[model samples]
Target chain A: MTFRQSPTRWALADGRELLFFTLPGHDCEPVPDRRSLPQRCAAQSELRFDRTTGQWVIIAALRQDRTYMPPADRCPLCPGPSGLTSEIPAADYDVVAFENRFASLTEAGGSAFQLPDPADADFVSAPSHGRCEVICFSSDHTGSFAGLDFRQARLVVEAWRHRTAELSATPGIEQVFCFENRGAEIGVTLTHPHGQIYGYPYLTPRTEQMLQAARAHRTRTGTNLFADVLAHEVRDGARIVARTELFTAFVPFAARWPVEVHIYPNRFAHNLLDLDGAELDEFTRVYSDILQRLDRLYPTPLPYMAALHQYADTDAQREGYFHVEVMSTRRSATKLKYLASSESAMDAFINDVRPEAIAEMVRTA
Target chain B: MTFRQSPTRWALADGRELLFFTLPGHDCEPVPDRRSLPQRCAAQSELRFDRTTGQWVIIAALRQDRTYMPPADRCPLCPGPSGLTSEIPAADYDVVAFENRFASLTEAGGSAFQLPDPADADFVSAPSHGRCEVICFSSDHTGSFAGLDFRQARLVVEAWRHRTAELSATPGIEQVFCFENRGAEIGVTLTHPHGQIYGYPYLTPRTEQMLQAARAHRTRTGTNLFADVLAHEVRDGARIVARTELFTAFVPFAARWPVEVHIYPNRFAHNLLDLDGAELDEFTRVYSDILQRLDRLYPTPLPYMAALHQYADTDAQREGYFHVEVMSTRRSATKLKYLASSESAMDAFINDVRPEAIAEMVRTA
Candidate 1:
């Protein structure tokens, strides 16, 4: 029942071919001593693996949540004095970013465990030393990132750049991921218009897979993998939803989701800190176009889970290209794309819509 | 630009990987043709592949709707005499299980594709033969399965067994998956106390992966893979949440999720039909215990995703054992676990808590 102290491997039910990156001891022991529960829970924080196409998912157990739609009188993110939280100069903010009070990833040191097998009796700390931050998309608590103007989005992007640089400077910060969760449907506890930043201690599985693919591609083709992809999608225009000099928002031909989208830089950049002023405009405009289109697609605002990816700062194997991934649950106004047994267990997707069709519907004003 | 008529695979960001799935080629055309929105939406659907994980995802542009959540009052699964709907039997049902009107998998035949691949955009449907049945867990629409009484829950399980057996008898039906999705947090459209049953057309990844592992194990070790694992878990008591002759539930060492539990039958049973009479009491008690513990752990009911694993009806792969998987959200009542960049892009997990601590907490009951 000894779980791997680090990312390692485990035997599947067959017990022959070892599943790679298995944090072993999580299921080492049985809880009741009888072997298992009728409906017991797995003591897993996350399961990092590579999909055939190269996506990553952290199956962390303790996912961080926040309070959403709070009263105006209770301002948590704002500065102090009359404000319950820290306050700032009373002025219109264009996508202002800030540090989060509570983060799953933090500079604060804590014991993250490599859980014992449900059969085992001991636990080991999973070595995850990282930092977490929050990016305020706007000072106004009501509107969402989509509702904000392009300028506002750009400022937000700048804040991301600054934070990336700051976190990268941290000794243990390996990867910096920026993301947002909107709407109560997806368990967004806080209604404050904000996004999150997580500086990982090591490379996440998806990034590792991508890096492996990139390295493999580079070996075979002698070219940057993402650069070729960007060029191909831009020239092809088959799945391109929106485009600008800096960024191109498109629904990938092989969409893992029904309403999946990627807003990547046409020219490859490793992190937010790398984008210049002119590049920033392109990023902002394309993102704004996608957001606006997303809003118009549904009468009511949609709930979405999105992230900004970057290379790990302290990992041994770190080859990541920065990109913004926007996954909206709004496959339809009401029908969500739940990852059922087949999808979650087998890692397959049963998308109900074509990426091209959805791309065309991307409400580009 | 021409997409597959059925499932197809395409290259991803990296050339090394491929994305695969069936997405009807609704609006696609020859490399040169770029039709407007309506024209494209009218094309046949096609499937796409994910290169990273070699999984398939579909895109039916025709079914694409801006909105996904249907109005609660408009029950789509069961239509009554009110409009163009059919009603269930007038008899009182503790938990009703019925075939879905608009099923994703139908008995209707399609162009047959090969076994599987995400890169080979070569998926042709094979009579898309499968059944989708809904299990009404409770008469009370607002109450979730957690709120069900022992009798009601047992009835739901019975309904699942009946439906699984009935649906699995179909010629091509390989797997019978019975699952309940509650709470809008997990993107359940209908708030009604109902679950879903999918009699799959082909062997899902779970069965396939395990079958491969088992075959490899038999080739190497000359023994049952699950047999030794079960014995080992029985020997150790730490990770066992609960156990019974009919089912032994434990947290596996390599748990990818926070609170993931697996319920395995002491006997080698591939589906729910294998359960006898008295075995269900233990099942009911333990299941209830697990739910009670989970609900108690969190002041309110926690949001979790789970699946009842069944075997792939493939002749050689029937040796696989069925299990129930429960991955509770790693979120506390106040915060949510965001599957951001590192998680969504990478297949990795980082836990904030240890399983031993969690198991200790769960073991209290």
Candidate 2:
């Protein structure tokens, strides 16, 4: 993101400031730490770019073999609270949200990053600031979010609302991301009926971009980008994957997933925590419908990475739109939709199935 | 992405120009198609924001699934100077770079996409103005980019250079991208060793953002963001993955991939085509070394989507860092780096491994 510049704007009713950045060009100049520390990249993970989308794609490919893929019978999430142990503890509850035993975002507070000694062969890690909570979509580990009934799904939403509010209230927590990766096809390590929550310490990249764009729009036009784009998509109706009164699910103008759809508030809302109870119920209705449609689209349950886009912005980004994304990798039931080179190296995209085609499929389903 | 009333400045070698936008706002509004008469988002793929790294991420998750898993022996790309049928004949090619047969951006212009009648069940399409070409990395059907020797690799670079230039010169072309999808693990339809090229007609979302950021930097600080960042990264080498006299490979400050390494030209160049034969040969040296190291790290070849980043300023971005990115999908050759909701949604990354460790492995390998 652009540093020290005017924060990126969102078209929210209450403007919040943000910073957004475009992809960098071909310059390979090393970025100096603020402290002008000696080259310390020797032992740290650094950000890198994927050329196709001109995006900063990550490479956290861990040794899958190193993981202790536990058996389903011995699932940690299903046990009662008393049974929970150091690694896999027992937890009880129909719809429970608890801290992940092995979390990427730890509660330990420290500098955003530890400067690794360039000469050191191994990188030492510093404290990572963020919250990771697992949402028990169902008490039965065998069951999944898809198997949940309407009321149960509503409970999940209630839990989400509670957690979103709690996490957002915490200082230094910039964005609240809620998402679920279901099915082993997409590499869900845990077969438990659970989703995860991330309380970010900084504005996420997506939020940053949205906030930045919104801020710019507000500064120039006193308008909201989300409002404008949503209106356009709705009016055009080509990429509209699904829709309800409260939420409209459509293939984003720029979709990174095969069957990607953003569930935007018909009206502007900055974050999901801001949604009221009635809104929550409405959200579950539309949300379940979207998932059901996804399942019906194919015989097998879809493998997807769905996220809620909640912008953390400055007052200028008040115009930003808060939306939930359902990015399905269902190129086919058995096959995957890989983000190959053009989509990775260049900032361009080529969707084989037209948007209208996707919309029709979702609409009919 | 912001179409503001303030005259948008374009930083060129000469004076600046005020750019205006015709995009809709938060609400979808009817806007005229800049291409031809009836407007639709037919050709240009929609770009999405990657919340973690503040970059646009495109989901080119196309319907190439069935093709992706085709019988390796029957690969059309492997049949050089032969005809599958009289209608579709192949030609001799040691390292072939041809218009992709099943292309998202076809060499032949796309079919006209018409708006569906309100009653039509299927309605999804937009103007598609781009070219999709396949660049065979080797003549051997089973050979991979990793198998290629330095000379063969250099030729691949040459083919890329030729294609990039040709695509860039095309009237409708706005961005020229070159990338490779090596293994079936990532769903390679054809087993032949090959890559892809896309000549975009419009500036992609990621490029647009980069250009905008660079322009802003130029206007405010009279410097390029990439130049500054690159200089800084070089000064602090902790994230540095590999280094060549002409290029530097390092993890980005905001890397999205787990083992994502950026190979940037020491000098400012928009993309791979910018380099001459000697430079490209050297580039191939590092490129091939990295790929070899990648394979050495894992017994099985990794599934990855790599790209070459070039500026699609539509003639605007000056301070960009054009680089080649290779992100290993073998986070653990056995396990994929599953991007949880926090990663996919918030754009905030939680890399499980320290970057320094990844680099050290690569450096030693």
Candidate No. with top lDDT: 2
- Tens-digit per-residue lDDT, A1-365, candidate 2: 11121212211111111111111231111111122112211122223442222333322323222225477665655543333221222233445566554444544233333323322321223234566666668657686676788777876776666667767777656567778878776677777777878776555666666677666655656766677668878988878876677778787655556687778878788776667667777888888888888888888777787777665444743655777778776665566666555544443444555456677788888
* lDDT tens readout by residue for model 1, B108-140: 123343444322332222224455566666545
Give the CAPRI class of candidate 2. Answer: incorrect
For each candidate, C-alpha RMSD in Å? 15.1, 15.2
lDDT of 2 by residue, B1-365 (tens): 11222212222112111112112231112122121112222233333443312233433333343244456555655532333311113333345454443445432233432322222221233334567666667557675787887666766676676667656766656677787777766667776777777776555666666677667656766766676667766888877767878877776655556567778778887676567655676788888877877778777776777777776334575556688778765565566666556555555555656566677777777
RMSD versus native structure for model 1? 15.1
TM-score of each: 0.67, 0.74
Distance from true position, residue A226, model 1, in Å? 4.3
Task: Give Cα distance to truth, residue A237, candidate 1, Å.
Answer: 3.2
Using TM-score, give the best candidate's number: 2
